[model samples]
Target: MTQITAAMVKELRERTGQGMMDCKKALNAAGGDIEKAIDDMRAAGSIKAAKKAGNIAAEGAIAVKVADDNKAAVIVEVNSQTDFLALQDDFKGFVSDSLEKAFAAGYTDAAPLIADQESAREALVAKCGENVNIRRLARVEGDVIGAYLHGHRIGVVVTLKGGTVELARDIAMHVAASNPQFLAPSEVSEEAVAKEKEIFMALNAEKIAGKPENIVENMVKGRINKFLSEASLVEQPFVKDPEIKVGDLAKKAGAEVISFVRFEVGEGIERAEVDFASEVAAQLEASKK
Candidate 1:
């Protein structure tokens, strides 16, 4: 039997980026065969890493970069189970690398960027020991794309055509604050418009009791249009100057807001429900053991 020397283990550990004890065990198992041991560690470590995929990542960071000409930009969100993990070098480094890849990925399509069919997001579950998701991504290729990240909690990306940097950034700030889902009133779906009308009719129909069918229909349309405007970014009042509408401001400035994307961490994730009484009883039972 070949004696596994410390030097062989050290070299294998350096190459594999794995733990010291794990390297030592693999070396012992492989009879001091450095290459075989490194391969063994990689396989085992990756399996161990896979077990962490189920962990919920409700915390993480959003990042964005604008090209020099402002002709394009990339935005991404990398979520971790805890803020501490989000701040880790490995996690943060992966996010930046992902963003860089996105910029060069030919187009800004989110599906292709995050797709495990091509992306390694699923495989990464093992290496990071935490669920990491590209929660939301945005890319714009025309004229300008500007962005703002409000702390780690929220991110905004605005696409602009024929606008100055200040205008573009100010719009990004607006998106961060308002959190509208659609870029323009037209982008609001018919279903969403109908739903708003239904809610308004339910709430106010009593007050307008016995109103004519035409009058009721007109009232519903009025309410639905207002709802669409509120839910759409272009129709919303500009954050800097409430007197001017966002869309109108763009037109006045010789530009248009092509679209925007906003991501608020944990916004779409359903939080786990905790049964407090049951949890307390379980804890008590465990303590008595």
Candidate 2:
């Protein structure tokens, strides 16, 4: 039997982009022969899977898992290269399994959970012939937690200090729909307000020009106030009951919103634009050669 050293594992990981444990296992199986380990990993589709890592996986699902006792909930976003693959049972199953593991471990950061699921993710990538990624995870915990999923594309988790699960769920649903940026006016940062003010002034520069200074200041303040009301979750009108605000609704329920996490599929990923017809033509041209 040959011994595998840390340097061997590190070399394998660097060469293949595989997890440390996987590299160690492969090295051990290959009798400490780095070349043999590489060959075996390539044959097992691990290398092929890693090669697909560069593909942008901006399409996928958001999964939410709430604890049995309703004290905590986890929301995760997993991505695939295309929506077609994302909708497949295999990819959905991976997302579900990943969310369960994160929730079970009470993982606030996605790194460890992602590491734990590396093998499964690589397998899915190899099988599906696309890039798959466990993009992010968010955990919310409080006296009461409520979670809502909107057609697997959007998920929201809400934490409340003193509220019924039903109320919390309602708020979560609202969040999934409204996608507010801040929990309240207090949570809105001064920088954000300043940015908004700058944009508002620039857009209305002509109208505010030559106006009285106090009047202009009043106009800017009013616009900033409106911006805050729109951007803050508590100030938004309840989706179910347009007559009432979310803050008022929570206050009526004797519940205070602690925090909320809302995730929408593919929110921030920059995807490559492919010309399908040209791609097909190129493929056909290559085939002729």
Candidate 3:
């Protein structure tokens, strides 16, 4: 075997971020071949990532980037099994690159873009491990698309028909801050509306029924109207100025909100549970050997 020197171990550790001892072990196992040892360490990391793939990385960062000429925009999310990876430079760059790819492809559908992104992300997993996922990608192309990124885990893409660039960007920022379920009241599902009404009547039935039946009917109507106002995007009170409705705010700014998409990372994705205490115990038991 080639000499496994301190310098070689150091180099291996720097390359893989594996512990010094782990690097030395891999180097030794690879007959002191640095390149082979790197491969070995990478495979090991991949295994580690796979074992923890069941963990939910519901928390991650959100980012948005706009195309030149300011005509298009992309919003993307990269989820990891832990926030630790989410904060890493590699993971952030991966998100940006994936978002760029989505825009380049002009893909508005989530599934096809994800499929196209799977290969590049899997390659990242080879280095960073399977904790990484191109969770969702969105693109907008119309008269104009503006983007806003609020920290990580919340990104917005707001499209407009004919609006000032500043107005579009502010609308995008508003969306990032106030997440709306749908663009218009017309888009709200009947089932969802019924469910809300059911819950409302159930909770206030006793108080509302004391009046005449006609009055109670009006009461329920009022409640349903309130629900629609609260649930609809344009009707909802603007986050920036609660005194004004969002649509009214847009009108005041001389902008029209064509449409918008807000993807809070892993909003609807079912995430697996992890038992951190038990996992720590198992690791401890293995370490004792």
Candidate number with greatest TM-score = 2
If candidate 3 were superposed on the true structure by all CA atoms, what would the RMSD be?
Answer: 7.9
Per-residue lDDT over 128-169 for candidate 1, one digit per residue giving the tens place of the 0 to 100 score: 556677776777667777778898778877888888777888
Model 3 clash count equals 4
The better candidate by lDDT, 1 or 2, is 2
What's the lDDT of the predicted structure labeled candidate 1?
A: 0.76
In the range 174-250, model 3's lDDT, one tens digit per residue, is: 77776777777888899988898799889997898678889887887888788778767788887777899878777
* Best lDDT among the predictions, by candidate number: 2
Q: What is the lDDT of residue 147 in candidate 3?
A: 76
In model 2, which residue pairs have backbone atoms overlapping below 3 Å? none
Q: How would you order the candidates by TM-score, starting with the best?
A: 2, 1, 3
lDDT of 2 by residue, 8-51 (tens): 88878876789999999999999998767876897987785444
- List runs of model 1 lying over 4 Å from the truth: 1-48, 110-129
Off by over 4 Å in 2: 1-41, 44-48, 277-289
Candidates' TM-scores? 0.75, 0.82, 0.74
